[model samples]
Target: MSFANCGLPYHIGGDIKDRSKLLLQTPESFLARFNVDVRVMNEVVSINRADKTVTIKNLIDGSKYTESYDFLLLSPGAAPFIPAIAGIDNPLTHSLRNIPDMDRIIQTIQTNKPKHATVVGGGFIGLEMMEHSTNLV
Candidate 1:
């Protein structure tokens, strides 16, 4: 999902009402605009520099294919850090990183309707989640 990651909290806080606004571009739109084939659910398992080919796995079908490319760019983003604390694996504990995470948080908030929330990290995402969560509660 190519979206404005920074605006996740605002969206959850009801500041950004339209969820479509958070999406920067769709794969089809990106391909149409830039003529670049953006594969979303494909994972590059391995790269062969000698052959200039990459072995990609289809996440949906579990099928593997090799594609040759002139240039390969890697931009694996960060993962939410879960501290090694007791009850850290609880379902209520959420980390805001991607759209799915944000959705889960919203669903949890709506379903559980907890009165209080404990935000862990003090980073941009964390602070935004805290602010939005407060507004939500």
Candidate 2:
């Protein structure tokens, strides 16, 4: 139901020496702990409040299906906001919103080995990125 250790990339490097420590819960652990079906890599495309149903698409094969529910809780998190700046779309610039984004940022830092990195926001996520980036230096 959730990416358990989203905050992990901030603590671990690209090599990921100890995956067990980083992984907060596995599918088996989650099932045993909460007795809930965990669906991973599925995207909720639409919700029908009238019928109390949600339409979800399998991210792997692009196949979609619908499921009825008595109640639905939507928790679509926010994406990193990139301002309309020149060269913001450049390959060198990166933002950390998900695990992939964090991986790419780490890869860029390791490969390029930049002396300085500029984090735009002073928010929690921004501060985390700044801290991780500082560790690389």
Candidate 3:
């Protein structure tokens, strides 16, 4: 999960040659290598402790399903801690999350050519983003 944060910062810095390299295992490989089911583009919406089932929504389509598991590992990974602000949803603000956020920030930097950028957060990812953006300068 920590490596996920590591992935985006490097992409932001243009350190990683290819975006696919960030993945340790492809969805198919993860399923094949381990006897685990890898469901790509599935959004886990809720977990029912009483029923011992996890509700998942397919991100691609609007289909929803449930999975019953004897044991479950909640490893969604840490998301960029974006605090709620009045205008935070405005077009300009962006936080480095998954590939899309990294891509959007990079495109914004290249297209807009902003002189100064402010990255808020004192966490590891924030520090990494600072180091990455400095190289871009």
Candidate 4:
């Protein structure tokens, strides 16, 4: 997620049109290069702070596992934050959170061809999310 949205800012800067270079680090590269061990598609269902342990499961597979950590970093830059609309979910709305959400937004736009999208929150993250939809940016 950190390096995935790299190309969107360029839209604001008017640098490039497409954003293929933004998604440079795959799960393997993020893990191997940074030594961060990025467990792709994994959900942290529970966190035991006292024990310094984290419980996770892969979204693709139902396998469960636990990891011990000396310290934890919580930097989920975005989440599916809806504004309590009457029928927001009915019209296929979304927010940027992870790699899967990016894919979903891309696929939805490709299949539905959405036009005149109304992005609610106006901030850094909202800008990033909206800028990314421009030709799969």
Estimate the TM-score of every prediction: 0.92, 0.81, 0.77, 0.58
lDDT of 3 at 82: 68
Using TM-score as the measure, the top candidate is 1
Model 2 scores a C-alpha lDDT of 0.73
Model 1 — which ten-residue stretch has the worst lDDT? Answer: 125-134
Best by lDDT: 1
C-alpha lDDT (0 to 100) for residue 16 of candidate 2 = 51
21-89, model 4: which lDDT tens digit per residue? 556677777877888766667998888999999999878989889999899988655555678878887
lDDT of 2 by residue, 107-130 (tens): 787799889878788888777666
lDDT of 1 at 46: 98
Residue pairs with backbone overlap in model 2: none
Q: Which scores greater on TM-score, model 2 or model 3?
A: 2
lDDT of 3 by residue, 1-137 (tens): 11355778988788886877776766677777776777878898999999899999998997999999899888766865668878888777898777778789889888887777787787888888888888787
Could you tell me the TM-score of candidate 2? Answer: 0.81
Q: Give the Å shift of residue 95 in candidate 2.
A: 1.0
Could you tell me the C-alpha RMSD of candidate 2 in Å? 2.8
Model 3 clashing residue pairs (backbone): none
Q: Can you tell me which runs of candidate 2 are displaced by over 4 Å?
A: 1-9, 12-20
How much does candidate 3 score in TM-score?
Answer: 0.77
Clashing pairs in 4: none
The clash numbers for all candidates, in the given order, read: 0, 0, 0, 0
Model 1 TM: 0.92
